[model samples]
Structures are given as C-alpha cells and as structure tokens.
Target: MFNNNKLALAIFLAVSGASLSGCGGGGGSSSNNNTTSSEPTWTAGVFEPSSEFKDQCALPRTGNDPYNNNQPYPDTAGSEFTEKMWLRSWSDETYLWYDEIEDNNPDNFSSVAAYFDQLKTFERTDSGAYKDQFHFTRPTEEYFQESQSGVVSGYGINWAFISNVPPRELRVAYLEDDSPAANVGLQRGDTILMVDDISIDTNTQQGVNILNEALFGPTAGDSHNFVIRSNDGTEKSFTLVAGNIAQTPVQNVDTLTTENGTKVGYMQFNSFLSIAQPELISAVNKFKANNIDELVIDLRYNGGGLLALSSQLAYMVAGPANTSDYFYYQTIENDKQPKSDPYPFIDFEIDYSNFEATNTSLPDLNLSTVYILSTDNTCSASEALINGLKGIDTEVVLIGGKTCGKPYGFTPTHNCATTYYSIQLTGVNYKGFGEYSDGLVPSPSPQFAADVKGCELDDDFNHQLGDNDEALLSAALYHIENNTCPIVVESSSAKQPSFTSQAIQETGLPLTIKQPLYKNNMDLTRPLPAKEGNNE
Candidate 1:
C-alpha cells in the first residue's frame, strides 16, 4: 500500500534537490547538432510496459477497441511505448521537453519508477535518492511480524499477554472524533496500557511500533483489543476500529494568570498550519475582551509548518509598522567566485505591507514583553516567531531550553514521475538586535539553579521538561517579579565571575592602586591629570 507513487511523491516533497547543466560537442556530424534543438527521444529498456507505468502510460493491447478500428492491437499502446522509449534514450531531452510543456511539465513527473530510471541515468547524489530507495520497497509479512514483536518485547510487554497501568494518576490527551483512536474509546488523557495483549513500555521503541500496528492496520475498519487505565484508576478492556482522523494544528486560549496575581493571556500555537491565522486572531480577540495583562506564547514543542503563518504571528506580536525591522539571513555557496572575504549569503526580510490588524481592540497586555516558552523541540516557525517578536522591540523572554537549530527552510520541486523534492536552498538568518542562529539558549540564573537543585533533592524532577529544565521560564518569572530582563549572553561569557573578585569589586575595601597618586610631584590637586588622562 505504501508503494503508491503519489503518496511517495508527497513524502519526497516534504524533504527533498538541485539541477545544473553541462555541454559536450559532437565530433563527426551536424545531424547531432540538429537533433539537440528537438525533444530528445527515449529507448525502451528490459522493463518495458511494466506494472509501474500501466496507469500513467499505455499498456500492451489485449482486447479489441473501436478507437483502434476494432483490432486487438491498439495505436495508443504503440504510441505510449514509442514515447517511453524516446524518454529513456535521452532523459535530459525529456526534461527539456517537460520544461517547455505547460500542463505536462517535467517538474510534475510523479512516478517512482520514472525517478529510479532518471537516477540511474543522471547519477545524481542528492539525499532524495536514498529516501526514494527506502520508500519504494515492500516489506515481507514475516519481517513485519518479527519487527512488531521485537518492539513489544522492548517495551517490557509480553507479546502473548495483557497488562494494565494503575488508574487515577494518568494524564490523557484525547484523540479527535472519527480518529482511529477515538473509535477505540481513546478519549483525551486516556491512560493507555496495552494493545491487544502486549503492554506498553515508555522507554522502548517497541512501544511505538505496537501502537503503529494497532493504529495503522492493513485496511480501514481493522480492530485491535485495548487495555486502558482510566482517570478513576479502573482497568478496562475494549476493542477499537481504525479510521481516518482529521488533525488541526492550533490551540487557542483567552487568558492565563501569573503567580503574582498578573492576568496573563496565552496562545498555545501547536503548528503554523492553514488554520493558524484565523484561530490566532480569534484567540487574541478573546484575550483583549478579558483584559489580559501579559501574553505567554507556548511554542515548547512546535517543530514548524507553513512560513506564511510564522509571518502572520510575527506581525501580530511585533505590530504592523515594524515588519522590516528584522530579516532572516542564510549563507549560500557561490562556486564561480570563491573569495576570501565571505560567501554571498541572502537575507529574507519579512514583508509587513499587507499585514492588517483585523481587530483594533488591543489588549491590556504589554506588547513590549512577549513570553516565549521554548524547548529543544521548538524549531522553524517557532524560531521565526520569536525572532520576529524581538525585531519589533517586544520583550521576547524565551522560557525553556535551547531551540532546535533548524533555521533553514525549503521549497518544493519536481524530481521525476510522481516524485517531488523539497530542497533547503534558502537559509533564514534573522538580522537585527537579538537575531540569533545558534538557537535560544536558556540562561539559568542562580535562582533557577537553586530551583532545579531543589527539584533534584526532592526527587520531583518533571520529565515534561524533557532534556533541559524550564530555566528560561524561570528567567522570565524572575524578570516579571524583579523588573529585570534577561539578556542573551554570548557563549564566551557563560561562566560566572569569581566570587572573590566580585566581592572585592563591590565592597572596594582593599583598593589596589595601579598608578601613583600624583605624577611628577606637581602641586596638590593640580588639574587632576586633565580629567581624560585619569584612567580610574
């Protein structure tokens, strides 16, 4: 089922390459030169009229058709085969023709088999070649079964038996209606334990494999036995059928509250998908109505989505007038002119000319301070949003771990038949004050250190913090409480100064005089070294 070339094409386009041309001269004939202007022809290989191109191109004629004069042999089959053979002979010629064609462009070649053939001819070494190979193959049933069994075992779950987690202490995230999970009674925050007879182990890859087995069956309506631990701690067993699930990206909120009685607003942006802009505006309006004093945008796990959504969020936080204040930068290799100074890089400036505030009712929250909850998983659009916020002088207090270092974005292109590729041809480097590329590293202060140490001592470390503690959040809270903002200190100065030196500098008790009190033994208080000359 995964062998469908169209689906493969979609996946290929998600992460995909570039093209260049070279010329060679023919030794003997002007005929070769004349042929170059015309579309290149193809020759059929041993795999002619294979199942791969049956749907797209014509196949071997079997039955009589009126279009072909009621003959067993059809002209369409012959014509298609002739075209296929011509395409095979000079692949570049096919591409050239594809470029010239309006509807049947070469870029829209969406066949896996066609791409394979092209790769064999061009010998391209792009990453797409590897991914294409991986996706085209069909796995054996024995291989799949063993793989699933291995995953279940790794999770410390017995493949032949059922087990359950103790109830009442589990957190649940609900699967939406019509989802494979929803049909199985997998409500929001349902504490899952076992699928069929196998128990789940959180630390093992097998756990994920088992879930996939149950969730993605061979066909729709596939059922799986589930053992669940509900919120009330009751152990129950049920059967769930698999089906399609619609997933929306944005989660909105109207208001939040800080520890110091501060009424904060929140917008938990999960992704920059198609529905993000409208949802965000609606959420903002609700916050304005509620008189929110602060805004906390949680992007702790947003890995990114559409770039347009990122721009919209940036405009909302940074205001419409200051769109050009920041720019995203990237480095590109200019092979023709390799120089000593630097490579020619490009900068993509966020255009705010069309950003219109649909709701003029601005909230009570301080636009100068935007609390951004980040983490290592926060990447792409998340980074863009934070950078955009900073561009307009919004106090973007990033609260969490360092961001995922993936500032580069991609644009999609056609590779071959039914196969598309997304190439990371451009890089986004935010230019302006607080623009960063190494990612937002949390600067954990003394107080943050203390809180983490305390958590460790109490054995209450929350795994929800993932790899890093919520040090950035602590910094933001500190700023709100003490009215001191956190600054991005460079890596060179990450280490704190020595306590002895700090104490001496602060107290000024034992002063170390570097120079003589009076030079040349001049009259007492004579002009004081002309002011500028006094280094101290």
Candidate 2:
C-alpha cells in the first residue's frame, strides 16, 4: 500500500545482481534518506510462536552448531542465531520493505539486544513517537514460559504511573489473585507510597529506575517494602516477597444493572493467552445465559497475544456475521509467500496458547454491537480485533484512551537459548487494510480515517477500573443508553508511564507486537465455514 520498496528483494537479488520491490501494507520499509534519525531505543521483549510461519529460521534443527539449541551455548551463540533468524524471518518475512544496506549487513551485533536494534524497518519519526514503533524482544525462556503457562514471577502488583510530571504517583491498577500485592491487602485504587524505602515517584530519573528494578527485576523469594494508602485514606506498610504469579487473562466477569434494569456484561480481558479462551468462554456463556443486552470489553491493559485468540474473541463477539467471513489476512514479503496464511472467523481446531484444547469455535456473543474499553496498552491483536470487527461492518464502540496502534505482530523464533522476535507479519482485515502505527485513536472522524468505532473520552480514574462507575465503563454505559457521548470534562492530564498507551519513551522497551505461533500441523487449505464474502 506504500511506495517503499527493495527490502526482501534486496537479499535474494543482491547475489544475482538484480533489483526488486516489495508489496502490501503497514510494514513495507521505506527509504532512510533523512539526514538525522536518533539511534533506535530497542530492548529485549518476550517470545511467542507465530501462527503464520513454519520455517525454523534460526540455526538448523539438525545442526551441531553452537547457535542451534541442540548444541552447547557459545559466547557468540545469541548473535549467530539472531543473525540467521534475521535472514530467514526478519529480512525475508517482514511485511515492511527493507533497504539494501540494512538488508545485507546483518553482522553488526555484539549482543542479541544490539542485533535487535539493527532489524528495525522504519525511518525515524520526529514527533517523539515511532511511526514504525513495533520493534521489541525479550528473554526467550521467560516470555515463552509465561505466555504458554499464563504465569509470571514478580511482586504481582499491576501498578501504573498515573502522572507524567513531578510527583509521578504509582497507583494500583489491579492485583493478580494470590500475588504478593493481593496477599498484602493491596487492591486497585490503592496508592503505593514507597517502594523499597526509596520514595517512588516519576519526578526523578533515579526513582523511576529504582522503581522499575523493584517491580520487574527481581526473582522469586526477593522481598520489597511498600507503604500503601487505602481508598479510605488509611496508610500502612508491608514487606512482601515476590513469588510466581499466575495471571488469569479474564480477570473479572460481571453484569452491571442500570437503573432501568438493562443488563450489561463487563469483562476485563488483561491479555490474550491460552487461559483466555476458557475464561472468556466462561464469561461470555454466562453473559449469554443472562441475556445481556450489551457487552463491555475492557482491554485497557491488554498488550495483545495469540492471533488465534484474537480471531476467536472477534468471532465470539460478532458470531454469525463472522461465521464464514474473513477475520484477517496475514501477509509477508513476496519471497516468503508460502508461509503466509489467512485467519478466518470460523477456524478449524488448531492448538492455541501452548495447549491442545477441545473445540474449534469459541462460544459466540453474537451481538450486533460491541463496546470496547481501551488504553495505550490495547494494541496489536487487540487493535487487530477492532480492525477485523470494523472490516466486517460490525458496530464497535471504543471508549477511554486511544488504542496502542500496532498493525504488526511477531512469532518468537530462536536459535539455542535466545528467542529472536522480528516483525514478521503485517495483518489486514478482509478488505485488506493495515496502516495504523500512530494508534487507533478515539475520534469522531469518518470510520476508516479515525480508526476506532466511536467517539473519544479519556478514562476516569477516580474509581478502580472494572468498577460499575469507573470512567471508561461509565462512558460506554452512558453512550449505550443515551446514544451520545459524555463530555470530556477537564481532569488531570498527566498519566503514568504506559507502553502502547503513551508515545515511545526513552526509559522503556517498545512493546508493539506479539501473537501466536503457527501450529506445526496447521492446514493452510482449511475451508471457510461459510461462503466467502457472506457478511450479508
């Protein structure tokens, strides 16, 4: 869809002395003719398999090479695996076109993280946001284990820096059941007065860094102290040790009763993972049983995972309109077309989220309209869901902050130990549209231009999220009843540091893409459940 060309073609043709161009949308690499673009702020992100790829991409599965998982680790193992995988996946499979210089020179790395920096495929965006910000990687083992098992090890406090400037306060967003935070009586809307005896705030760089380490840098059995304030204005302190946290993606499922007896189902879908299917099914089935008139999907903190789940969730919401209709078309560079596939609404039984579960279809909500609660973290597959729903002409109401726009996604490929996640796919809806890097902002523009379905209203943080009276949910409820938006009344504009919810920051990793790996025995020829273009 863009004019940028010569990425994938540059690799193969360079050996043969020929030149070629790229195809499709979103990820196609454009020229880097700018005189100055800052060095990329790349970091290690988590790993998951891609549903659209079958190639090993890294060191050969049968090889005795150190870079291969079968062999012993080399001091240079990660770089070698990263280089090869970059050739197989990043260079060849990326939806974005690459320049000849960046395409052929893959040896510029002393570490895996450094190697990751060189694989980014966009010209520098100057407004302090990544026009092409989908680059990210993570420790392979940790991410793979967590994504597959729905578990993580940490303080278990889902906290957010709600203010951007001085005195940046950390507030509890929610708590995982049985987590350290939850065990210590910490709950949503609580304020963390101190972390590790270091007065935590966003005002100073040292404080934020210390807070980051205290929050995510520790292993199980590690302990940190925090002074917390309850909603009733009582303050207390506790020393909590870290432990393994089991994160259930569907955190809350309840029905809200309006004064007029209208039943609205509310579900806080945290992330898209294996556990999500069962949890989501359980919630939706209950909503269905209750005969819910409207549904509110709270994806405010969902960073996106598993394309299959995204498709499943979309189908569950749209039902018959989705049935045989196309959900998303995943496209790669021209050279790797064989690995590409289409994800339809009604998919055959394929293993998803590291488990082979029963049934191919998710229980459908079958609603004509869906209300989505969002934030900067509502990205990748979440945004893809919004795209898929809109493409099928389903009514989607977007409330809260603008969505973290990421039309791209990745499957974490690996060498030996380090899994390499390159931006290997650009997803489009049935009509084939995928160019929303800035994000699907909530605005009142035309459908295709403004991106999200409904009018814009910033989230209300006066109450905890998922509460019947929370800002975002209240807006959705308000709109559902009145058929118009509540006014964006003046409130504190400062927000905590959020990924995908806010612009690219110098202090954090850009978490723009993540999704499921292709099932090993996936049948590319699986037929649509209904006729093509049967949205009618």
Candidate 3:
C-alpha cells in the first residue's frame, strides 16, 4: 500500500472495481450553513450509500489536475451537509467498529472535518486508551506528497519529547545522513533548550505554538535557530534550514563478531518505504554472504510504512521453505464484504517504487530466529512482521520496551481533496491471532501470543545506534551469546542537565514526539473486497 507511482496505482484501481477520488486541488468550503427549521432533517440511524454524496463538495475545485495527467476535477457543487453525509455513510460502511459508533446528525455538524473526527467509535481498549486512536484526515496534496513521494519538508531530525510540560524536555532522537541536524553535529540525547529564541519550557500557548511550528512545521527553506545542551553539559547553538529530506530507510548495516566468535548482522531500519526494498535486499545479501549466525534489526524508531516491504523482509529472514503459506489474513467489517485473500510472504524482489515484481529471487538468510530491537515507536507493519514470522513458528525475540499497539489498518479514501483514514480492517496472522491491542511485550515467560521472549531495556541515548555499546543492540548481542537476558544497571551519578526553571505539572503529555497518524498506521493498497458487481 506504500506505492509512490500514481500511474501504476491508477491502472490497478481501474481494474479493481474502484475509481480514484480527490486528485484535484481545493480547500474545504467555509459555508457552515447550520440546519434551519425549513431545512430537511435526518434520523440518526438512517443513511444513504456514500456514493450518493461523494464528490459533492461545498466549494468544488476548478481546472484539471497537473499531477494526474491534467484530468478534470471530479467535484460537483453541493453543501457542507452533503460532504458530512458522505463521511457518515463511509464510516458506517467501512469502519471496523461501525456498531460502536454513535450515529449523530450530519446537519448538526458545522464542517466536514469536524464531522469526520466524531465519526470514529469512542470505545477504549482494556488499557484505557482509545480503541480507534488512529482516526484523522489530511489534505490530498499533503498525503500524496509524503506517502507517494516519501519526501518530507523538515530538518531531517527526529525529535524525542521526554516531557511536554512547563519544564518540557526535548532531545535529539536521531538524524538522517547529510541532514541539517547531523550536518550541524547534533547527536542523540542532546537536550533542546530553545527554538528560535523561544524557550522549550515556556508555558504560554503562544510559546508552544511557536516552538511546535519551528520544530515540526512543514515548509522548505524555513530557517530556525536552536540551542541545545550536550550530554557532557556543553551548550551550543545552531541555525537549521528545513529542506526536502528523503529518508535512508536502512542504515548502519554491519556484521559484528561476538566475543564468542559468532557473527551477528545488525542494521538500523528506520522505515518501510519503497526505497527500503533495494537497501534491505543489499543488507540481507551482505548478511547471507557473511554467514551470519544471527540477525538483529534495530526498529526502535521505525514507525512502519508499507506492508509489502515488511512481508518482503520477513521472507528474506525465513526463506521460501518456511514462508510458503499466507503471511496474514485481513478481516473487514462483518457482512460488508467477503473475506480478503491472505497476504502471501513475498519471495521475489519487488520494485516497490512502482509496485512491480522484479522476478528476481530474494536472497535469504534462512534464519529461524531473529532479534528485533523495539520500543513504543515500533508499530503497524513492523508489528505485522513480528506477528507474521511468529505465525510460521519463527522465533522473534523482541528486545526493549513494548511496541506501539496497532493491529488495525485502513485504505486511504479521499473525497473533496481530503484523504480520510478510518480503521477499516483488522489483520491476523496465519494462526488466526491479532489481538495485541494492548501491545506486544517482552517477558521471560510470555503468557499471551503477543508477548515474546526477551529483555525489557531502556533506550540508551548515550551511544550511537548500531554501535556495539548501545543499550538495545548490545542487549540483543548479549542475549544471543548468553542464552539469557542480562541485568543492566545505570550509573547513579550520570544525569542529564535539566532546565533551570520551575515545573508547571509533575508530568508531561507523552514521552515521544507525536508523529502524523499516517506514520503510525498501516495502509491497505491491494484491492479491497467490493459487493457483487460493485466497485469501491
């Protein structure tokens, strides 16, 4: 589902009983037009087919789309009510938890986005977290730019927010090679003190807006100044200009010789983008050539991308002998459509840039067991890889904290130039298991299928990733050699310099920087099941 080529997607969609929507450019209409006494009223449960109101935009776009071969815009003149109704029907039809959603009157909502936001089920998981936390929307332009192009306008730095209170703590998590942050010598664990003269710990909403915009804002060539404190208590300043950064999905591929003379392959895999196909193939081939006795993949920061790429990696690890069956089975809304075909473990190399098979047999390590370095940031397709391999009895030893719980995915359906993502499908492994909504954890004796055997270690930012001394990677190596998890104790005297200011609250919003909903969710690009004689 992570293809970047639009022409290829168009051909597939044409034959797959679906038509592409929202390819043109236009913003949402400002006409709220609240329901008046003379206006038509609707019952809560009563609905129409989403196609009835599809592309009926309040402010229809003009002119042909330059991105889509100058195709005419599909939008037609309508009201916000029509747009909202389209979203409501779409949710009722496609949402995985449609029964749990509260049917609200579309006329009561003011805008399409507001109504779309409330369309998701408000149910929570047993862990007290929202069951459907991945619901969101983005302009079609923005979605395609990031998803299709795999290019983002940023400083090439992934920030880790330890806290987000008055005494907020932000640190440099990692950087892309030749990135603005890496070019300026910013290393992991360096605490950010100020951004463009605004203190990171500032309590004012205005200050928060400025800080967020300067750090996460999406605009090329936008310059911002930053002040950071190093791990050794050294203060430094830098000016970074944002640019289009194409991420190096795979990095730090190396074969490490353990103290016991066992060869282990280690690589820091950042994302599952299309560009990852060739890189991953190269890395696996190197490992295979080196005759690595074991493999350790650093996925602590990989928020996942394409499912195909994930399946490809799994095939390389397990090989065709073990992966001759379905990788996973996708289940959609009950009775809405027929059961989908199982995702097979891909064995041939794919030019994911165009979603085509290269016809070349993938190099396999034939490893029965693999060590995966993970954290809360590891999610979606990354988790799918773990579940897929485990389905075939492959031992996936997870090292580090629990993964970000996400077993659900959706097909990005666009309408009115806005790409809306709602939970539509729940994928399970060949073993018919996918209930890890609370997240997969590491325990000596895992009670549930989601739990794996490994150690729960803290992410050590003191050392560079893929380094021999790094915490998570080191734990994996030690586990391989000793056949047991090691007990790691931290030095008491080592403390990061905190902001010299008063704290507003005892805690902060969250530990990690908030990523876009797309980054954390799986995308389904294969043909979805449609009703008989109906194309979705």
* Residue-level lDDT tens digits of model 3 in 227-259: 999989999998999998877879999999998
- What is the TM-score of candidate 1? 0.48
lDDT string for model 1 (1-536, tens) is: 01111110000001122232223211212122222233322221222323332222223334564322465532233223233333332232222122221222222234334433343222222222222111111222221222112111111111111111111122232233344454545443345576778655432356545654553332445667878776466878887654333333445464645677777666656555433545676776677678767777767646565444565465555543444434422223223212211111111121112221122322222356677766545665576566555444565666656665444333222111121212222233344322233455544332421111110011001222211223444455556665564454445413221224455445432212111110001000001111122231
Q: Which of the numbered candidates is closest to the native, going by highest TM-score? A: 3
lDDT scores of the candidates, listed in order:
0.37, 0.59, 0.74
Q: Which predicted model would earn the best lDDT? A: 3
Clashes of each: 26, 22, 0
Q: What does candidate 2's lDDT look like per residue over 1-536, in tens digits?
A: 11111101000000011122232111212212321132111122311233222332233233344323446433221224333333334444443544422432223334435545555554643345655455445555565566557777777766555653334456777778778778778878787777787765444657766766776566788888878888789999988898878887797798988877789999998777656767887898899999999999998877777666676678888886554535444444435455444555643233442233334456777888899988776777788778888778788888877876666655554444455455545667776777776678776555555466566665555587677777788888888898778786665663545433343354433221122121110011122233223333
TM-score of 2: 0.75
Lowest summed lDDT window (length 10), candidate 2: 6-15
TM-score for candidate 3, please give it.
Answer: 0.87
TM-score against truth, every candidate = 0.48, 0.75, 0.87
Residue 491 in model 2: lDDT: 59
